[model samples]
Target: MRIVVAPDSFGGTLSAREAAEAIAAGWRRAVPGDDVRIVPLADGGTGFAEVLHTALGGTVHTREVVGPLGDPVTGSWLEVDGTAYLECAAACGLHHVGRADRVPGAARSATSYGVGQLLADARSAGVRRIVVGLGGSATTDGGAGMLAALGLVPVDEDGLELPYGGAALATCARLDGDADLGGIEIVAASDVDNPLLGPHGAAAVFGPQKGADDAAVAELDAALGVFAGVLATFAGREVRDEAAAGAAGGLGAALLALGAGVVSGAGLVRELVGLDTELDAAAAGGGPAITGEGSFDWQSLRGKLITAVARGAADRGIPCVVLAGQVSVGRREAAAAGVDSAHGVADEFGLEASMADPAGTLAELAATVAPRWGR
Candidate 1:
């Protein structure tokens, strides 16, 4: 028998690769003869580089880049088969903010300039294809910060450059001096397709999640609206609230302006790692496919990686099981996302005990379920 092991990162407890390995070990112990394929997944978030690296046998490159708060932080990228996989969180992740510094007014200083630097490096390396994964960012500049870093100049009425952040967009008079981005293809990786402006826009819908207060959210929304207006004058089309414009603090809007294509984060990762093919091969050999994530909330079924896995497996007529760190939905909700069954790792053990021995507990759980797979 064959079994496909694909799961997302278990948040702080374990990475997707580690969790998959531990689960596979347990499944092996329980069902000795079963052929298992481990396919760890990510939605372009914190653990994206490592997960993609493991899946594609790619190389991970580390570099020092300006963080969300302008401090130097270690950033990373995945180079697989000559394609650069850029994770926005590596440079502008909200996790970089300290609990003490978790103030919305302060986070307003955060920008995605570091991501522009990463893209510059990738361009310098002569990479033809670049895929940017957008998640866990700590900025709301509508990608203006990133654009400025890539050599685009945003100046005010008096002909002085403005500071990076969404708050200053209202003062932007003209966008000057384009960059030398020649023949570069950028694919935006995001799950949410919200527009860049308005009530449901970036600042309104997501600013609070990044610690912004109501007033701050309103200000950012206005700023982004102005920025979109300026961009429309240049691009000759209104990009306000364009699909995926709100991804990564309006990073999507910026990329959209630069003519980058956008796709589902889960779909991109799956195709990049050949995950669906692996699952298909496993199902052909007669075994169920397993997939999951750190937490299974309502959004889990809303175009996330775990749901993507279940859909792919189900398309092949294979039953898919899920093992999450925490499962918040019922069977109906799970099935709505094509999940046959879903269970949390915490359900099998005490929360404290599980946290202490996550790898062991995960392995043991997989081993317990191995025999049911006809192994």
Candidate 2:
């Protein structure tokens, strides 16, 4: 038997690589004579570059950049075949903000400056194309900091530059485009399809998780409105309501204004990693593909890594099983989402034990479930 194990990172616990390895080990233990293939995956979030590097054998480049809260931090991107793959979360993600700093006050001051710096560094590498993974952002700045880092400073009526963070967008006057992209193509790999403004927009949907209070959410939303309006004027095109324009705290809008194409993160990574070819090869052996993440919820069905993988496997008639830390969706929902089978570690070992050792629990679950797969 041939089994392909592909999974996203289990949140802060097991990374995709670790989860794939553990699942492979368990599958081997259960079916000693079976062939197991591991293909760790990501959805343009925290581990996007890492997973891509693992799959495509890219060179990782690290650089020093500004953090979410105006601090110095080290960030990295992947350089593969003259294209740079950058994960915005590496420099400006909520994960970078310390627990002590995880406050509403901090959200107001978070910036995407590091993301800009990373892009600049990638460009410095002489890469003709740059792919930015837009997720896990800590800021609702409407990408002002990123624009500033790219030589487009936001200034007030007094010609004074606005301070960092989303709150400063209220006083912005105009964007001064000082640097040119010089024909480099930029692609934004976004996780969500939310626009840059309104109830379902960036600030309203993601602000609370970033530590914004009710008032802050409202303030940030309005500020993004101002920012979007200004960006539209600068670009001479309507960009606020573009699909996925609200992704990554309105960073999607910024990328759009810069003429970047917005694409599905999971889908982009899958194609780049040649997932179809791998799945076809595995399918030829009459093997099923197993993929999953930390949770199998409604969001997981919406263009997430697991969903993309499952759909790809399904297209080729390869059964795709999902192994998650927690499976909240029902059998019908899982089936609808193109998942052949869904197993939760918590279901078998209880939530506490599963949370304590998710990797081990996943391994155990894989071993128990392997024999059940169609021979």
Task: Provide C-alpha RMSD values for all models, in order.
Answer: 2.6, 1.9
How well is each residue in 180-215 modelled by candidate 2, as lDDT tens digits? 777899999987788899988998988988888899
**Where does candidate 1 stray beyond 4 Å?**
29-33, 57-60, 80-82, 198-200, 347-357, 364-375
lDDT of 1: 0.82
Query: Highest lDDT: which candidate?
Result: 2
Given candidate 1, what's the lDDT at residue 93? 84
TM-score of 2: 0.94
Error of 2 at 162 (Å): 1.8
Residue 64, candidate 2: Cα error in Å is 1.1
Give a tens-digit lDDT track for model 1, residues 53-103.
766777777889888888888888878777899999888887777767667
Minimal lDDT window, size 10, model 1: 99-108
What's the TM-score of each model vs. the native? 0.89, 0.94
Clash number for model 2?
1
